[model samples]
Target: MEKNKTIKRAFIASLPVLAGYMVLGIGFGIMMRDKGFGVLWTAAMSLSIFSGTLQYVGVGLLAAPATMIQTAITSLIVNARYMFYSISMVKKYKGTGKYKPFLIFGLTDETYTILSGETPKDANENKYRFLVTTFNHIYWIIGGITGNLLGQIIPFSTRGIDFSMTAIFIASFTEEWIKKNNRKGAIIGVVTTLVCLLLFGEKWFLIPSMLIMTLLLSIKPKREAAK
Candidate 1:
Protein backbone atom coordinates (compact mmCIF):
# COMPACT_ATOMS: atom_id res chain seq x y z
CA MET A 1 0.00 0.00 0.00
CA GLU A 2 2.73 2.45 0.88
CA LYS A 3 4.69 1.51 -2.21
CA ASN A 4 1.69 2.12 -4.40
CA LYS A 5 1.10 5.47 -2.78
CA THR A 6 4.71 6.52 -3.37
CA ILE A 7 4.49 5.51 -6.98
CA LYS A 8 1.30 7.49 -7.32
CA ARG A 9 2.87 10.59 -5.91
CA ALA A 10 5.95 10.24 -8.09
CA PHE A 11 3.75 9.85 -11.16
CA ILE A 12 1.76 12.93 -10.29
CA ALA A 13 4.92 14.92 -9.68
CA SER A 14 6.20 13.90 -13.08
CA LEU A 15 3.19 15.29 -14.99
CA PRO A 16 4.59 18.76 -15.61
CA VAL A 17 7.84 17.26 -16.85
CA LEU A 18 5.85 14.95 -19.11
CA ALA A 19 4.12 17.86 -20.76
CA GLY A 20 7.34 19.78 -21.26
CA TYR A 21 9.30 16.83 -22.66
CA MET A 22 6.56 15.97 -25.12
CA VAL A 23 6.50 19.38 -26.70
CA LEU A 24 10.29 19.68 -26.80
CA GLY A 25 10.76 16.14 -27.99
CA ILE A 26 8.24 16.71 -30.75
CA GLY A 27 10.10 19.78 -31.83
CA PHE A 28 13.36 17.82 -31.94
CA GLY A 29 11.77 15.02 -33.90
CA ILE A 30 10.44 17.49 -36.42
CA MET A 31 13.93 18.87 -36.82
CA MET A 32 15.42 15.43 -37.25
CA ARG A 33 12.88 14.58 -39.92
CA ASP A 34 13.57 17.82 -41.67
CA LYS A 35 17.25 16.98 -41.56
CA GLY A 36 16.60 13.71 -43.40
CA PHE A 37 16.84 11.23 -40.52
CA GLY A 38 14.26 8.47 -40.62
CA VAL A 39 12.28 7.04 -37.72
CA LEU A 40 14.96 4.51 -36.79
CA TRP A 41 17.64 7.17 -36.57
CA THR A 42 15.41 9.38 -34.50
CA ALA A 43 14.51 6.56 -32.11
CA ALA A 44 18.12 5.50 -31.78
CA MET A 45 19.34 8.99 -30.98
CA SER A 46 16.52 9.60 -28.54
CA LEU A 47 17.20 6.34 -26.76
CA SER A 48 20.96 6.67 -26.66
CA ILE A 49 21.86 10.36 -26.23
CA PHE A 50 18.84 11.02 -23.96
CA SER A 51 20.18 14.38 -22.80
CA GLY A 52 17.50 16.81 -23.94
CA THR A 53 19.58 19.81 -24.96
CA LEU A 54 22.49 17.69 -26.04
CA GLN A 55 20.24 15.51 -28.14
CA TYR A 56 19.01 18.53 -30.06
CA VAL A 57 22.57 19.74 -30.42
CA GLY A 58 23.57 16.24 -31.43
CA VAL A 59 21.39 16.59 -34.51
CA GLY A 60 23.60 19.37 -35.75
CA LEU A 61 26.68 17.46 -34.72
CA LEU A 62 25.50 14.41 -36.59
CA ALA A 63 24.90 16.46 -39.68
CA ALA A 64 28.34 17.98 -39.50
CA PRO A 65 30.00 14.70 -38.38
CA ALA A 66 32.40 15.84 -35.73
CA THR A 67 35.39 13.76 -34.71
CA MET A 68 35.04 11.75 -31.50
CA ILE A 69 37.36 14.17 -29.67
CA GLN A 70 35.24 17.17 -30.54
CA THR A 71 32.08 15.32 -29.57
CA ALA A 72 33.59 14.39 -26.20
CA ILE A 73 34.68 17.96 -25.57
CA THR A 74 31.30 19.35 -26.46
CA SER A 75 29.52 16.86 -24.19
CA LEU A 76 31.85 17.56 -21.29
CA ILE A 77 31.51 21.33 -21.55
CA VAL A 78 27.74 21.19 -21.70
CA ASN A 79 27.31 18.59 -18.95
CA ALA A 80 30.11 19.46 -16.55
CA ARG A 81 27.69 20.91 -14.02
CA TYR A 82 26.20 17.48 -13.62
CA MET A 83 29.24 16.63 -11.57
CA PHE A 84 28.02 18.99 -8.86
CA TYR A 85 24.56 17.47 -8.99
CA SER A 86 26.02 13.99 -8.59
CA ILE A 87 28.02 15.12 -5.57
CA SER A 88 24.84 16.06 -3.71
CA MET A 89 23.22 12.74 -4.55
CA VAL A 90 26.14 10.69 -3.24
CA LYS A 91 24.46 10.16 0.13
CA LYS A 92 20.93 9.76 -1.25
CA TYR A 93 21.98 6.99 -3.62
CA LYS A 94 24.63 5.44 -1.42
CA GLY A 95 23.30 1.91 -1.08
CA THR A 96 21.83 1.47 -4.52
CA GLY A 97 23.16 -1.67 -6.23
CA LYS A 98 22.92 -2.35 -9.95
CA TYR A 99 20.29 0.31 -9.76
CA LYS A 100 23.06 2.84 -9.25
CA PRO A 101 23.94 2.97 -12.94
CA PHE A 102 20.35 3.54 -14.02
CA LEU A 103 19.85 6.14 -11.32
CA ILE A 104 22.93 8.00 -12.42
CA PHE A 105 22.01 7.75 -16.07
CA GLY A 106 18.60 9.31 -15.46
CA LEU A 107 19.66 12.07 -13.08
CA THR A 108 18.59 15.11 -15.07
CA ASP A 109 18.01 18.55 -13.52
CA GLU A 110 14.30 17.94 -13.15
CA THR A 111 14.71 14.46 -11.66
CA TYR A 112 17.26 15.67 -9.16
CA THR A 113 15.09 18.61 -8.15
CA ILE A 114 12.03 16.43 -7.59
CA LEU A 115 13.79 13.65 -5.76
CA SER A 116 15.99 15.90 -3.64
CA GLY A 117 13.02 17.91 -2.40
CA GLU A 118 11.03 14.82 -1.37
CA THR A 119 11.80 13.12 1.92
CA PRO A 120 11.13 9.45 1.53
CA LYS A 121 8.55 8.27 4.04
CA ASP A 122 8.31 4.80 2.61
CA ALA A 123 10.64 1.82 2.96
CA ASN A 124 11.00 1.53 -0.79
CA GLU A 125 12.66 4.87 -1.29
CA ASN A 126 15.01 3.58 -3.94
CA LYS A 127 12.15 2.05 -5.86
CA TYR A 128 10.23 5.28 -5.68
CA ARG A 129 13.17 7.27 -6.98
CA PHE A 130 13.91 4.76 -9.70
CA LEU A 131 10.35 4.73 -10.93
CA VAL A 132 10.16 8.49 -11.03
CA THR A 133 13.41 8.80 -12.96
CA THR A 134 12.56 6.00 -15.33
CA PHE A 135 9.09 7.38 -15.88
CA ASN A 136 10.45 10.77 -16.89
CA HIS A 137 13.01 9.23 -19.28
CA ILE A 138 10.33 7.15 -20.95
CA TYR A 139 8.23 10.27 -21.38
CA TRP A 140 11.06 11.90 -23.34
CA ILE A 141 11.75 8.82 -25.41
CA ILE A 142 8.11 8.30 -26.27
CA GLY A 143 7.67 11.95 -27.11
CA GLY A 144 10.70 11.98 -29.38
CA ILE A 145 9.63 8.89 -31.31
CA THR A 146 6.09 10.14 -31.62
CA GLY A 147 7.30 13.51 -32.84
CA ASN A 148 9.57 11.92 -35.45
CA LEU A 149 6.70 9.84 -36.76
CA LEU A 150 4.42 12.87 -36.81
CA GLY A 151 7.03 14.86 -38.66
CA GLN A 152 6.85 12.45 -41.56
CA ILE A 153 3.11 13.01 -41.85
CA ILE A 154 2.69 16.63 -40.80
CA PRO A 155 3.69 19.37 -43.20
CA PHE A 156 3.84 22.49 -41.02
CA SER A 157 6.92 24.62 -40.40
CA THR A 158 9.06 23.70 -37.39
CA ARG A 159 11.17 26.85 -37.50
CA GLY A 160 10.66 28.17 -33.97
CA ILE A 161 9.98 24.88 -32.30
CA ASP A 162 13.59 24.62 -31.13
CA PHE A 163 12.83 27.37 -28.65
CA SER A 164 10.88 24.86 -26.61
CA MET A 165 14.14 23.78 -24.97
CA THR A 166 14.82 27.38 -23.97
CA ALA A 167 11.33 27.59 -22.51
CA ILE A 168 11.99 24.47 -20.47
CA PHE A 169 15.20 25.97 -19.09
CA ILE A 170 13.39 29.17 -18.13
CA ALA A 171 10.60 27.26 -16.45
CA SER A 172 13.08 25.15 -14.54
CA PHE A 173 15.02 28.21 -13.46
CA THR A 174 11.83 29.95 -12.36
CA GLU A 175 10.80 26.96 -10.27
CA GLU A 176 14.21 26.78 -8.63
CA TRP A 177 14.23 30.52 -7.93
CA ILE A 178 10.79 30.37 -6.31
CA LYS A 179 11.70 27.45 -4.06
CA LYS A 180 14.99 28.95 -3.00
CA ASN A 181 14.96 31.40 -0.12
CA ASN A 182 18.55 32.45 -0.73
CA ARG A 183 18.54 35.71 -2.60
CA LYS A 184 22.31 35.87 -2.70
CA GLY A 185 22.68 32.73 -4.78
CA ALA A 186 20.02 33.76 -7.27
CA ILE A 187 21.47 37.22 -7.67
CA ILE A 188 24.92 35.82 -8.28
CA GLY A 189 23.63 33.46 -10.94
CA VAL A 190 21.78 36.21 -12.81
CA VAL A 191 24.65 38.65 -12.63
CA THR A 192 27.31 36.16 -13.61
CA THR A 193 25.32 34.78 -16.54
CA LEU A 194 24.50 38.26 -17.81
CA VAL A 195 28.09 39.38 -17.67
CA CYS A 196 29.33 36.22 -19.31
CA LEU A 197 26.74 36.46 -22.05
CA LEU A 198 27.90 39.97 -22.83
CA LEU A 199 31.57 39.13 -22.80
CA PHE A 200 31.57 35.68 -24.39
CA GLY A 201 28.38 35.68 -26.39
CA GLU A 202 25.99 32.71 -26.30
CA LYS A 203 28.31 30.22 -27.97
CA TRP A 204 31.21 30.37 -25.50
CA PHE A 205 29.86 31.94 -22.31
CA LEU A 206 28.11 28.99 -20.63
CA ILE A 207 31.06 27.24 -19.00
CA PRO A 208 32.67 30.36 -17.61
CA SER A 209 29.35 31.65 -16.33
CA MET A 210 28.55 28.42 -14.56
CA LEU A 211 32.02 28.14 -13.03
CA ILE A 212 31.94 31.69 -11.71
CA MET A 213 28.39 31.33 -10.43
CA THR A 214 29.27 28.14 -8.61
CA LEU A 215 32.27 29.77 -7.02
CA LEU A 216 30.28 32.78 -5.90
CA LEU A 217 27.38 30.74 -4.58
CA SER A 218 29.78 28.48 -2.69
CA ILE A 219 31.00 31.48 -0.74
CA LYS A 220 27.50 32.64 0.22
CA PRO A 221 26.84 29.87 2.74
CA LYS A 222 30.23 30.37 4.35
CA ARG A 223 29.65 34.10 4.66
CA GLU A 224 26.22 33.49 6.15
CA ALA A 225 27.73 31.02 8.62
CA ALA A 226 30.33 33.59 9.71
CA LYS A 227 27.53 36.13 10.21
Candidate 2:
Protein backbone atom coordinates (compact mmCIF):
# COMPACT_ATOMS: atom_id res chain seq x y z
CA MET A 1 0.00 0.00 0.00
CA GLU A 2 2.77 2.46 0.92
CA LYS A 3 4.75 1.64 -2.18
CA ASN A 4 1.74 2.16 -4.40
CA LYS A 5 1.01 5.50 -2.77
CA THR A 6 4.63 6.52 -3.08
CA ILE A 7 4.59 5.67 -6.78
CA LYS A 8 1.45 7.73 -7.26
CA ARG A 9 2.96 10.68 -5.46
CA ALA A 10 6.16 10.42 -7.42
CA PHE A 11 4.19 10.33 -10.68
CA ILE A 12 2.29 13.45 -9.70
CA ALA A 13 5.44 15.26 -8.71
CA SER A 14 7.00 14.28 -12.03
CA LEU A 15 4.17 15.68 -14.15
CA PRO A 16 5.97 18.98 -14.66
CA VAL A 17 9.22 17.23 -15.59
CA LEU A 18 7.25 14.97 -17.91
CA ALA A 19 6.21 17.97 -19.96
CA GLY A 20 9.66 19.57 -20.02
CA TYR A 21 11.62 16.40 -20.78
CA MET A 22 9.17 15.37 -23.49
CA VAL A 23 9.73 18.60 -25.42
CA LEU A 24 13.47 18.86 -24.78
CA GLY A 25 14.09 15.19 -25.46
CA ILE A 26 12.16 15.47 -28.71
CA GLY A 27 14.26 18.44 -29.71
CA PHE A 28 17.38 16.41 -28.96
CA GLY A 29 16.06 13.46 -30.92
CA ILE A 30 15.12 15.56 -33.92
CA MET A 31 18.56 17.11 -33.99
CA MET A 32 20.32 13.76 -33.69
CA ARG A 33 18.04 12.30 -36.36
CA ASP A 34 18.77 15.18 -38.70
CA LYS A 35 22.42 14.43 -38.08
CA GLY A 36 21.74 10.93 -39.51
CA PHE A 37 21.78 9.14 -36.20
CA GLY A 38 18.93 6.72 -35.59
CA VAL A 39 16.60 5.94 -32.65
CA LEU A 40 19.21 3.73 -31.05
CA TRP A 41 21.65 6.63 -30.78
CA THR A 42 18.90 8.90 -29.51
CA ALA A 43 17.80 6.43 -26.85
CA ALA A 44 21.36 5.70 -25.81
CA MET A 45 22.18 9.37 -25.37
CA SER A 46 18.98 10.10 -23.48
CA LEU A 47 19.48 7.15 -21.16
CA SER A 48 23.22 7.42 -20.65
CA ILE A 49 24.18 11.06 -21.16
CA PHE A 50 20.93 12.45 -19.67
CA SER A 51 22.14 16.01 -19.52
CA GLY A 52 19.77 18.05 -21.70
CA THR A 53 22.11 20.91 -22.52
CA LEU A 54 25.14 18.66 -23.02
CA GLN A 55 23.21 16.18 -25.12
CA TYR A 56 22.10 19.01 -27.36
CA VAL A 57 25.69 20.29 -27.56
CA GLY A 58 26.80 16.69 -28.09
CA VAL A 59 25.12 16.47 -31.47
CA GLY A 60 27.90 18.58 -32.92
CA LEU A 61 30.61 16.76 -30.98
CA LEU A 62 29.41 13.32 -31.97
CA ALA A 63 29.41 14.31 -35.61
CA ALA A 64 32.93 15.72 -35.52
CA PRO A 65 36.18 13.73 -35.11
CA ALA A 66 36.86 15.12 -31.65
CA THR A 67 39.40 13.43 -29.42
CA MET A 68 38.55 11.86 -26.05
CA ILE A 69 40.37 14.61 -24.15
CA GLN A 70 38.34 17.38 -25.78
CA THR A 71 35.10 15.56 -25.10
CA ALA A 72 36.08 15.03 -21.48
CA ILE A 73 37.01 18.69 -20.98
CA THR A 74 33.87 19.98 -22.68
CA SER A 75 31.65 17.70 -20.60
CA LEU A 76 33.39 18.72 -17.40
CA ILE A 77 32.96 22.41 -18.14
CA VAL A 78 29.35 22.26 -19.31
CA ASN A 79 28.02 20.09 -16.50
CA ALA A 80 30.18 21.48 -13.71
CA ARG A 81 27.15 22.91 -11.89
CA TYR A 82 26.18 19.37 -10.95
CA MET A 83 28.83 19.59 -8.27
CA PHE A 84 26.85 22.31 -6.50
CA TYR A 85 23.57 20.48 -6.85
CA SER A 86 25.08 17.29 -5.46
CA ILE A 87 26.32 19.04 -2.35
CA SER A 88 22.79 19.91 -1.24
CA MET A 89 21.66 16.34 -1.81
CA VAL A 90 24.38 14.71 0.29
CA LYS A 91 22.27 14.43 3.41
CA LYS A 92 19.12 13.39 1.57
CA TYR A 93 20.90 10.61 -0.30
CA LYS A 94 23.03 9.26 2.53
CA GLY A 95 22.45 5.62 3.42
CA THR A 96 20.05 5.13 0.52
CA GLY A 97 21.82 1.80 0.07
CA LYS A 98 20.39 -0.13 -2.88
CA TYR A 99 18.73 2.89 -4.51
CA LYS A 100 21.74 5.18 -4.32
CA PRO A 101 23.32 4.24 -7.67
CA PHE A 102 20.33 4.97 -9.89
CA LEU A 103 19.33 7.95 -7.78
CA ILE A 104 22.72 9.51 -8.33
CA PHE A 105 22.79 8.66 -12.03
CA GLY A 106 19.26 9.98 -12.60
CA LEU A 107 19.68 13.28 -10.83
CA THR A 108 18.68 15.72 -13.58
CA ASP A 109 17.67 19.32 -12.87
CA GLU A 110 13.99 18.51 -12.86
CA THR A 111 14.48 15.36 -10.82
CA TYR A 112 16.48 17.31 -8.29
CA THR A 113 13.77 19.94 -8.00
CA ILE A 114 11.11 17.32 -7.36
CA LEU A 115 13.12 15.24 -4.94
CA SER A 116 14.32 18.28 -3.02
CA GLY A 117 11.10 20.26 -2.95
CA GLU A 118 8.22 17.87 -3.48
CA THR A 119 9.48 14.93 -1.47
CA PRO A 120 6.70 12.85 0.02
CA LYS A 121 5.88 12.48 3.70
CA ASP A 122 3.82 9.28 3.58
CA ALA A 123 6.56 7.03 2.25
CA ASN A 124 10.21 6.26 2.81
CA GLU A 125 12.19 9.22 1.49
CA ASN A 126 14.67 7.13 -0.43
CA LYS A 127 11.97 5.00 -1.99
CA TYR A 128 10.01 8.06 -3.03
CA ARG A 129 13.14 9.62 -4.42
CA PHE A 130 13.87 6.51 -6.46
CA LEU A 131 10.37 6.42 -7.92
CA VAL A 132 10.53 10.09 -8.96
CA THR A 133 13.86 9.60 -10.66
CA THR A 134 12.58 6.53 -12.46
CA PHE A 135 9.49 8.35 -13.73
CA ASN A 136 11.49 11.26 -15.16
CA HIS A 137 14.10 8.95 -16.69
CA ILE A 138 11.40 6.85 -18.33
CA TYR A 139 9.74 9.97 -19.71
CA TRP A 140 13.01 11.11 -21.28
CA ILE A 141 13.67 7.73 -22.88
CA ILE A 142 10.17 7.46 -24.31
CA GLY A 143 10.21 11.06 -25.53
CA GLY A 144 13.54 10.59 -27.26
CA ILE A 145 12.43 7.39 -29.00
CA THR A 146 9.15 8.93 -30.08
CA GLY A 147 10.90 11.94 -31.54
CA ASN A 148 13.42 9.77 -33.39
CA LEU A 149 10.64 7.61 -34.81
CA LEU A 150 8.81 10.71 -35.97
CA GLY A 151 11.99 12.13 -37.40
CA GLN A 152 12.39 9.02 -39.52
CA ILE A 153 8.86 9.50 -40.84
CA ILE A 154 8.88 13.27 -41.32
CA PRO A 155 11.57 15.79 -42.09
CA PHE A 156 12.00 18.87 -39.87
CA SER A 157 13.13 22.27 -41.11
CA THR A 158 16.69 23.09 -40.13
CA ARG A 159 16.02 26.74 -39.46
CA GLY A 160 15.16 27.71 -35.84
CA ILE A 161 15.24 24.07 -34.70
CA ASP A 162 18.15 24.66 -32.33
CA PHE A 163 16.18 27.34 -30.53
CA SER A 164 14.22 24.53 -28.93
CA MET A 165 16.94 24.35 -26.33
CA THR A 166 16.45 28.03 -25.50
CA ALA A 167 12.74 27.48 -25.36
CA ILE A 168 13.27 24.73 -22.82
CA PHE A 169 15.28 27.05 -20.59
CA ILE A 170 12.68 29.76 -20.76
CA ALA A 171 9.91 27.37 -19.86
CA SER A 172 11.85 26.01 -16.91
CA PHE A 173 12.68 29.49 -15.66
CA THR A 174 9.06 30.55 -15.95
CA GLU A 175 7.93 27.54 -13.98
CA GLU A 176 10.41 28.28 -11.22
CA TRP A 177 9.45 31.94 -11.19
CA ILE A 178 5.84 31.10 -10.48
CA LYS A 179 6.81 29.72 -7.10
CA LYS A 180 7.37 32.28 -4.33
CA ASN A 181 10.53 30.84 -2.85
CA ASN A 182 12.03 30.12 -6.26
CA ARG A 183 11.50 33.71 -7.42
CA LYS A 184 14.75 34.99 -5.95
CA GLY A 185 16.73 32.14 -7.47
CA ALA A 186 15.19 32.81 -10.87
CA ILE A 187 16.05 36.50 -10.67
CA ILE A 188 19.58 35.70 -9.53
CA GLY A 189 20.03 33.31 -12.45
CA VAL A 190 18.76 35.75 -15.09
CA VAL A 191 20.71 38.67 -13.73
CA THR A 192 23.85 36.63 -13.36
CA THR A 193 23.50 35.22 -16.86
CA LEU A 194 22.91 38.64 -18.43
CA VAL A 195 25.67 40.35 -16.50
CA CYS A 196 28.07 37.60 -17.45
CA LEU A 197 26.99 37.82 -21.06
CA LEU A 198 27.72 41.55 -21.11
CA LEU A 199 31.06 41.13 -19.37
CA PHE A 200 32.30 37.98 -21.08
CA GLY A 201 30.35 38.02 -24.34
CA GLU A 202 28.22 35.17 -25.63
CA LYS A 203 31.02 32.66 -26.06
CA TRP A 204 32.23 32.74 -22.46
CA PHE A 205 29.17 33.83 -20.45
CA LEU A 206 27.69 30.41 -19.83
CA ILE A 207 30.32 28.96 -17.54
CA PRO A 208 30.82 32.14 -15.52
CA SER A 209 27.10 32.65 -15.07
CA MET A 210 26.60 29.04 -14.03
CA LEU A 211 29.45 29.24 -11.55
CA ILE A 212 28.21 32.50 -10.06
CA MET A 213 24.63 31.31 -9.92
CA THR A 214 25.66 28.10 -8.21
CA LEU A 215 27.60 30.06 -5.61
CA LEU A 216 24.73 32.42 -4.92
CA LEU A 217 22.18 29.62 -4.79
CA SER A 218 24.34 27.58 -2.45
CA ILE A 219 24.76 30.52 -0.13
CA LYS A 220 21.28 32.03 -0.41
CA PRO A 221 19.52 29.25 1.46
CA LYS A 222 21.89 29.50 4.34
CA ARG A 223 21.42 33.27 4.49
CA GLU A 224 17.66 32.93 4.50
CA ALA A 225 17.77 30.31 7.21
CA ALA A 226 19.83 32.62 9.37
CA LYS A 227 17.31 35.44 9.07
For this target, which candidate reaches the highest TM-score against the unseen true structure? 1
Worst 10 residues of 1 by lDDT: 160-169
Q: What is the C-alpha lDDT of each candidate?
A: 0.78, 0.79
Q: In model 1, what lDDT does residue 98 have?
A: 71
- Can you give the lDDT of residue 66 in candidate 2? 75
Question: Which lDDT tens digits does candidate 2 get at residues 1-227?
Answer: 98888878888777767767776777788888888899999999998988887898898889895788888988888787777678778988898999998998888877776676646678767788888899889889888888877844545444554454455456656665676656877788889999999999976788789888878877857777786
Q: Evaluate residue 20 in candidate 2 and report its C-alpha lDDT on the 0 to 100 scale.
A: 71
lDDT tens digits, residue span 1-227, model 1: 98788788778767767877777778788788878887789888777767877888888878888888988888987787678778879988998887899889888877777776654566377787888888888988888888888755657665665555556556666776788756676688789989999999988887888788878877757768686
For model 2, the stretches where C-alpha displacement exceeds 4 angstroms are: 152-190, 213-227
lDDT (Cα, 0-100) at 30 in candidate 1 = 78
